[model samples]
Target: MTGRTADPGLIGLLGFVIATLTAQLEHLGVQNESPVFWIGAVFGGVVQVTAGMLAYFQGDDFHFLVYNAFGWYWICMPGFLLGGELGFFEVAGPARGVFSLMFAILALGFAFPASMHNSVLPVTLLCVSGGLGLQAAGAFTGVELLGTVGAVLLLAASALAAYLLAEKFVWRTMRRRVVPLGRPWIAGDPDRES
Candidate 1:
């Protein structure tokens, strides 16, 4: 426990950002219908899911573990985006909604587990997943207002994390005086003890 363990929070943060983006894209009417969005979703999903699996094995109550597990949304979202972006899959809107719905389910399901271990990591991830779900619903349903909220959540989570990390590790120089010993405490030899 004293040694360093991989930060699962990164995966959580990834899921958060992606989820937020998913919501934002939905509002923008560019979610599954856009190739760029799909690319981002797929790439992000693979990273998150893989990280989550690793965390599961570590079995530490690190917050990152929860985030990674909930990241499966990455895989689902990209499928919708790809369908819309590629034109071969014409059910982009419905697909996005489906994935977004799935995100909500997964996010909620993992919430308690994360909270039971690490509060901040799980809370942030929850916010992100919720945002994604809202955005996806709005975008697919043509609700622009919900998209804006999603964007805000995304920005907020990122800003908060950055601030937390910066605050957590403050660099300071400590001045110390070096004391030199000219000779050993038991100077001449063992016979001196007598």
Candidate 2:
């Protein structure tokens, strides 16, 4: 497999940060859900999924899996909400819990493995998984606070992702790491930055 290309990781991180932050802001009542719908469909869906494909072409299987999974998540989840709002379909009550539970499971599965790479990946995954888990709890119990905490966790994840993207940009221009990505949970090669 080819391992040559402009970094798709940057694209994936950028999309992840934008979409997650926007969605979290909306979840916290700071932004309108309508604009978030577009952000999710385009930046979250198209850009991240395309980045996943690029990672696949680069022989980076882990990124291919992560970015694509979350890309589809952004697309499907937002579309489902938008569709419900438009009266196309209504998934309310316990059914919503079921749907959230499924995604929460997936996100949790990704979280631990992400620790092998860097603090960033694991932190992002754990935050997202925690957010989804809380969302599921919110749906099941009718507690808005659960969802609110979930939104805060998601915002934290987005902030971490944005830091990663900034780190890349600084490295590109300075030929040095100006913004550091913290150590991986599992130690890696001493020579490698991440």
Q: Pick the candidate with the highest lDDT.
A: 2
Candidate 1 similarity to native, TM-score: 0.59
lDDT for 50 (candidate 2):
95
- In model 1, state the lDDT of residue 69: 46
**What's the lDDT of the predicted structure labeled candidate 1?**
0.52
Q: Which ten-residue region of model 2 has the weakest summed lDDT?
A: 185-194
TM values, all candidates = 0.59, 0.89
RMSD of 1: 14.6
lDDT of each: 0.52, 0.82
Q: What pairs collide in candidate 1?
A: 8-64, 9-64, 23-135, 26-139, 32-81
Candidate 2 on 6-108: residue-level lDDT in tens?
A: 7788889899999998888998999788878899988998889999999899777778988999899888867777878987877677777787778778878
User: Candidate 1: misplaced stretches above 4 Å?
Assistant: 1-5, 11-43, 60-70, 160-194
lDDT by residue (tens digit), candidate 1, 6-107: 555454445545554554455456654454355446545666666667666666444344445445555555565566657866655656667666766766
